[model samples]
Target: MSAIARSTEPRLDSVTCASPAGLHRMAYWEWGDPDNDRVLLCVHGLTRTGRDFDLLAQALQGDYRVVCPDVVGRGRSDWLIDPAGYVVPQYVADMVALIARLAPARLDWVGTSMGGLIGLGLAGAALVSPALRPSRGRWGLDATPDVPLGRMVFNDIGPALDLDGLSRIGSYVGQDIRFASFQQAVDYVHAVSQGFGPHDDAGWAALTEHVFHEQDGQWVKHYDLRIAQPFALQTPDATTAAEALLWRAWDHLPMPALVLRGAQSDILSAETAQQMVSRNANARCVEFLGVGHAPTLRSEDQIEAVRRFLLTA
Candidate 1:
């Protein structure tokens, strides 16, 4: 892979993450002086890559060491051999390995949408996976607490899902096509993310980067089309069954929590985010205006809020 400096200042690292299934090489962008003991691992969302954090990481570099991992199916990380393996349990396994390799001890976490769910699944003191403890397949680990996942930031997703909104996402989950130009990609992004609402030109441009890949002299999305397969399993019956288990895990989380919801999010309702706060004494929440489903932490206010949440209260 041709290595280019991830940022204008030219500081990045090509890191490798080894998991039992395979030696999955992950390209991570690291910032900060490298001597800082405080580490924050940032995880990106489904159909998105870790590069999503470039702006936020750049801003937080001086205060905390940041490591961003492109989840298995999305970016530099190797696609899983089995599409069935793309579920949360498998993701949790890869994360445990990553924490062991990068943060052997406690550390901070920042996640966006799907990444946030992964972090909450791991660090939530009471969070449990039915698959993990079932007699059948369980994260491929028969035991629990594989690693210490510290404080977490859950972006929008939660235990209960809005079926209508979820199905809305499924409408274009795996359409096979390509855009003619970068601006076309940007327009498509805005169209799909109507829920996110009112981003400036730069914010819109940054979001476009999340799904970028170059092919045949054109820029397209990087993820495999099959990622939509999981959404099929999100059948009404299955989501109802799965959501309860997630809530149970939340009920038992042993660490501090921060839940941020887009004010207009259809997925994680305002009611549920508040319930999460009520459950944990240390848990707090903030909603970004004119946003739905997620708050991309690109705005100065968004960045400052996260910094304050992590470093202070």
Candidate 2:
């Protein structure tokens, strides 16, 4: 390949979504045929943008109508009025709105890190009893019933998370920092994302381009710093409760699920990856030997794994 960044382009668009605080616009990059009924929704991790999926999107655009979204508070999306709304439930709600707009005859999901958690929430919500379902008003949709996912690819994430990894992430996520030049910004990304495995200069540049934008003669991180507030406020008890709920959700899912783990990932432990597969009859696990925390899905092997599962499995 000439370079990872050189590929078919995508159309940028936005959908109106609602949260308890008010309405916000969630931006997404659309690839492939807009009218194609086979939809693949790709969601990025905690601080990454929708552009993170550019390579993967380009690879599979012809096979599926790939839609990658910049979850609220990140990328081109609008920031939430209430920082607390940065949680998974809110992300899931926004995704529902996006799904409604697409109205796909078939839908699949590929989520990395935080994105995986949001996918889990959606999968779980589909199995909830009618009485337990959230009101449509809460999701900002007048009629968004729980739509079943055809297949789900959980990229470097699982129901239970490593606290140490979370601590490491929190240490720098919302830091107030600016870069003097593009190379400086790229260097900062490399320092923080050593877990993404190996990539060349062009690969690193592709990752940094959408994450930082020039403002007032300085390069600043594109996401809202306030997005970290909820993470900092999380307590052990809350985390335990959330994990239990996620496990409950994971066990109840009926759709085929693919769990991708970075062998060295601190966030998704090997034990949890195995548990994820064992708990669900339709779930399976795959690990990338040298990767950690998450896989960018840009490499040939990573992309092929996802393609085979989503297209054939």
lDDT of each prediction vs. the true structure? 0.70, 0.88
Give residue 243's error in model 1 in angstroms. 1.7
RMSD of each: 5.6, 4.0
Give the range where candidate 1 is weakest over 10 consecutive residues by summed lDDT: 131-140
**What would you estimate as the lDDT of candidate 1?**
0.70
Candidate number achieving the greatest lDDT relative to the actual structure: 2
* Residue pairs in clash, model 1: 125-253, 125-254, 126-252, 126-253, 265-293
Q: Compose the digit string of candidate 2's lDDT tens values, residues 151-222.
A: 999999989999999999999999988988999999999999999999999999999999999998889999
Q: Lowest summed lDDT over 10 consecutive residues: which window, candidate 2? A: 131-140
Could you tell me every candidate's TM-score relative to the true structure? Answer: 0.84, 0.93
| Candidate 1, 1-313: lDDT as tens digits | 1122223342545445445565665556566645455668888877777777777887777666678877877766677666776777667667766654453234678988778778766754224453232121122345344443456777787777778777777778687768888888888888898877788877788788658766898886777767888867777788777777777677776666678788999888989888888876767898888889777777787788887787774
Model 1's number of clashes is 5
TM-score for candidate 2, please give it.
0.93
lDDT for 57 in candidate 1 is 84
State the displacement of the C-alpha of residue 159, model 1, in Å, after optimal TM-score superposition.
1.7
